[model samples]
Target: MNLENTLAFAKRQDEADELRDFRNQFLFPKHEDQNFIYLCGNSLGLQPKVTKEVMSHQLDNWANYAVEGWFDGNEPWMFYHKELKKLIAPIVGALPVEVCPMNTLTVNLHLLMVSFYQPKGKRFKIIMEGGAFPSDQYAIESQVKFHGYEPDQAIIEVFPRKGEDVLRTEDIIIKIKENKDEIALVLFGGINYYTGQWYDMEAITKAGHEIGAIVGWDLAHAAGNVPVKLHDWGVDFACWCSYKYQNSGPGGISGIFVHEKHFSNQDLNRFAGWWGYQENKRFKMEKGFIPESGADGWQVSCTQVMPMALYHASLQIFNQVGSFEKLRNKSIALTNYLEFTINEVNKSLGTNQYTIITPQDPASRGAQLSIIASQNGKQIFDGLMENHILGDWREPNVIRLSPVPLYNSFEDVFLTGQALLAITKKILKSS
Candidate 1:
C-alpha cells in the first residue's frame, strides 16, 4: 500500500474503492455552498440520508395511534427494541438474546456494576485504564464509594509506560495478574478516546477471568469502529453509544450486552423495573419481580421511539454493508493513507511539525490518528476549519482526525493533507 501525496493518486484510489458509493448516503456540512471535508466521525457520525424519513414514520405513528402506538403500528413500539437487537447483534458479535437496546451509556454502566461489581472479602478493587473517558472514571469512583471503599484505594489504573502514548498489552495483563487477589472487576474502554488505541479485548477478558474478576467494556469508541466478539470472548458485560461510528444522531440510544451465562444467576443483583419483568406477565401487575430472560432483563423502562427510529435507520445501512470485516478493511486503508500523507507533509517541511501518537500498527488502532502539532496547534486547527477541513481539536495540542469508511473518501483525505501542508507553510513563514 504505497501511498502517494498527489490528488491524482487519491482520485485513482477513490475510483477503485468498492464502497465509494457509501459517501452519497450521508449529508455533509457545507461552507459557503461547498461541502466540507468532514473527518470527525470518531466524535459524532454523519447522519444517514434515511434518518429523517424513518423518524417521520415514527412521528406519524405517534400522531395516528397515540397511546395504542405501542401495539398498533407496523413496527410496534412494544417490540421496537427487539428489532434493533437483531440488527445490532452481528455488529458486536453477540447473539440477539445477549444484546439489548436500552438506556444511556453511563446509566447502563452503573446498572451493570450493580450486578458485576459486588465486592466481598479480599476482592474489592476495580482495575481500569488510566485516562479513560471522564464519565467512566466518575462512575467507578462513585460506585466504589457507594460500597464504602475509598476511591484512591479501591480504583487502580494501568497507565502507559513513561514516554509512550499508548498502553502496552503486556503491561495491562501484568497489572491484572499483580492485583489478582484484590480485584473485583476489570473494566476498560474498548478504545482509548484520545489516543485511538484499540485494546486487545480478548486478551484482557481472558486475563481478568483468570484472576476471578468480572470483566466488562465501555465500547463507546470501539463498538462500530472495530470488530469485537463479546460473547465468544467471554466478556461478562459491555455497553456502547450509537452516536459515534455507528452514525446515529447526537445523544442517540445506547445498547448493552450481558452474557447468557449470567441469565440464570439469581444470586446476581439488579435494580429491577417493571420493563424488565417477564414480558408475557408484565401487564398482569404481579407480585415478586420475575426477571425476563437474557439481556432484556436489564431494561429499566419503555423504549424511546424517536431515537430508536434514527438508530434503526443507521442500522439498516450497517445491515446493507453485511459485515464489520468489510468496513474495518476500508477503515484501515483510509487511515493508513491519512497517516502517510501527514508524514509526507513533515518530510517536505524538513521538520517534524506533526507527530502522530496513535499506534502505528493497523491492528492496534482504528480510523483515528491523534496528531500533536509542533507549534500553534489550536491556530493550525482553526486554519483547517477555515479551509473547510473539519476535524476535532483536543486540549493543549492534539488534533484528532478520523476518516470514516461509511462516508469519507480518499479525496477527502487528500484535500486534508493539502490544507495541512499549506497551513504549515504559512505558519512557518510568519514565525
Candidate 2:
C-alpha cells in the first residue's frame, strides 16, 4: 500500500476499492458550491440516499392512517424495530432476540445501568475508563446517586499511566482485578470516542465476569465503524447509538444487546413501560406487567418511526454489502492510507508538526485518526474547514478525521492531506 501525494495513486486506490460505489450513496455537504471532503463520520455520519424515501413513507403513513398507523400502516409503527433487528443483528454480531432497537444512547445506557448496576453494601463501585464521553459520565454518576451512593466513592475511574492518551490492556486488566471485590459493573466504550482506541472487549468481559461484575459497553463509535462480536465476547450487555457511522441521521434511535443467558431470568428488574409487555397481550392493558422475553423486554416505549425508518434505510445498505468484515476490511486499508499520507505530510513539515495520537496498530483503531495539532490547532482546523474538508475538533489541540467506509473515498483522504498541508503552511506563516 504505497499511499502517496500523487493523484494517480489515489485514483488507483479508488478504482481498486470494491466498495467505492458506496461513496455515492450518501448526501455530502457542500461549501461554496462544491461538496466538502467529509471525514467526520465518527461524529455524525452522512445522510443515506434512501433516508428521505423512508422518512416520506413514515410521514405518509402518519398523514393517511393517523393513530391507526401503529397497526395498519405498510410497516406497522408499533413493531418497526422488528423490521430493523435482522439488519442490525449482523453488524453487532448478535442473535435477533438478543438485540432490540429503542431510545437514545444515553437513555439506553441509563436503563441498562438500572438493571445491571445493582450496588450493595460491600460491592458497590462502578469501574470505567477515565475521561469517558460526558453523557456516559453523567449516566454513571446519576446511576450511582440513585443507588444512594456518592459518585466519588462508588465510581472508580481507570486511567492510562501519566501523560498517556490511551489505556493499555494489561493496565485495564490489573485495575479490574484490584477492584474485583468492590466493583459491581464494568462499563466502557467499545472504542474511545476521543482517542479512537478499540478496547479488547472479550478480555475485559472475561476479567469483569471473573470478578463477579456485570460488563457492558457504549458502542457509539464502534457499532458500524468496526467489527463487533458481542455474543461471542460473552458480554453481559451493551448499547449503541446509530447516528455515528451508522448513518441513521442526527440523534437517531439507539439499541441494546442482552445475552440470551439472561433472557429466562425472571428476577431481572427493569424500569418497564407498556411497550415492554408481552406483544400478544399488549393492547389488552392487563393488570399485572408481564414483560416480553429476551432483549425486547428492555424496551420502555413504542418505537420512533422516523428514526427507525432512517436506520432501516442505512442498514439496508449494510445488508447489501454483506458483513462488517467487508466494510472493516476497507476501513483498515482506508485509515492506513490516510495515516501514511499524514506521516508524509509530517515529514515534509520538517519538525514532526503533526502527530497522530490514535493507535498505530490497525487492530486497535477504527477509521478515526486523532491528529494533535500542536502549535496551531484551531487555526489549522478552521483553515481546513475553509478548504471544504469537514473534520471535527475536540477542544484544545486534537482534530479528528474519520474517513467512513460507506461514503468516503481514497481521493477524499488524499485531498484531506493536501488541505492539512496547506492549512499548516498558512497557519505557520501567520504565526
Candidate 3:
C-alpha cells in the first residue's frame, strides 16, 4: 500500500476494511458531542456494548438464585472457568487444559514463581530484561529475597546494545549462555512495555531449556496484540492481564498458562486453597489437598462471577473475529501507517523532531508506536487530548499511540497526523 497523507486515502482504507463493523460494537468516549479517536488500547480498552447486557444478566442471576447461582444457572459459577479457558487458550496458543483465568497479572506471577522459581544453592539466579515494568521488578525482587538471596547478586538483567533502543535476540541468548549454570529462571515480557519490542519467545525458551532452566513470560502487552504459540514454543509458564487488548473492563480478570507437561507434577508446590481441590470430592472436605486435573488446580479461590461475565462479553467479540491471526494483518498495517505518518510530520518540518523508539519492523512490534518528540512533547500530547484525540503519555516525554486493529481505523491515523502537525507548529511558533 503506497501511503498517502490525505483524508480521502484514509476513508478509502476504512471503507474497505473487513473488520469495520466490529468497531461499532465498542462505546467510545466523547466530548462536546464528538467521539474521540481512541488509540489507547495498549493502556485501557474501550467498553463493548455487550458488556453491560452480560453484566445485567449476571446481576439478575444473583437476585434470583443468590447462593444457588453456583450450580443452578445456565452457566454455572462453579464451572465457568472451563468455558473461559476454552476461549482464552487459543489467544495465547495453548491447550484448553493448560490455561486458567485467575488472579491479576502480578499476583498470578507471584503464585507461579512460588512453583517455577525453585532455586538450589548454585543455580539460583533469575535472568530478565532490563527496565521491565515496575510490578515485575518488585515481584521478582521479593521472590529472590524470600529465597534468601541478595537482589543485586540474584537478578541478572539483559540490556540492549549501547546505541540501540531494543534488545537483540542473540544478545539475550548469549546472556542465558553466560549464566547457564546459575540461571534458575528466565522471565521476560512477551512485548517490552516501553520500547514495544517483541522478544523471540521460542528462541529464548530453547536457550533457557538448553541451560537447564525454566522459561516464563509476562504477556501483559502481547497476549491479544500478537499471536504466540506458548505450547509449541515449549514455554513452561506465562501470565497476562485481559484489560488492555482483550477489552475486559479495567482491572479485568487475568490469565495464566502452565504447560500440560506440568499438570501432573505433584512436586510443584502451590499455595493451595479449597477451590483447587478435586471438584467431585470438594464437598466431602476431608484431608489433604488433591488438586483437580490440568490448570484448574492452580485456582486459589472460588469463581468471580462479575469479572468473568465482563470478560465473557469481550471473549465473544474475539470469538466473532476468530483469532489474533485475523487481527495481526490489520495491526501491522495500522502501526506501519502511524509510523509513516510520524515520519511525514518530521519530514514536513525539515527536522527529526519526532523519533519513534519502537522497532520499525512490523515483526518486532505490535500496534504500539512509542514516540519521543524533540520539542514540547508534553505540550503536544496535551494538545491532542484537547482536540478529542486520546493517546496516552508516559513519564519523561514518551507519548504512546496504539492503533488497535479491532477498533482503530486508518482515518483515525490520518486525522491524528493532521492534529500533530498543527499542534507542533502552534507550540513552536508561540515559543
TM-scores, one per candidate: 0.99, 0.98, 0.99
Return the candidate ranking by lDDT, descending. 1, 3, 2
lDDT by candidate, in order shown: 0.94, 0.90, 0.93
Candidate RMSDs in order: 0.7, 1.0, 0.8
Pairs with steric clashes in candidate 3: none
Tens-place lDDT per residue, model 2, 210-271, is 99999999999999989999999889999999999999888998999999998888777799
- lDDT by residue (100-120, candidate 3, tens digit) is 998899999999999999999
Cα deviation in Å at residue 301, candidate 1?
0.9
Task: Supply the global lDDT for candidate 3.
Answer: 0.93
Candidate 3 or 2, higher lDDT? 3
RMSD of 1: 0.7
The pairs that clash in candidate 2 are none
Clashing pairs in 1: none
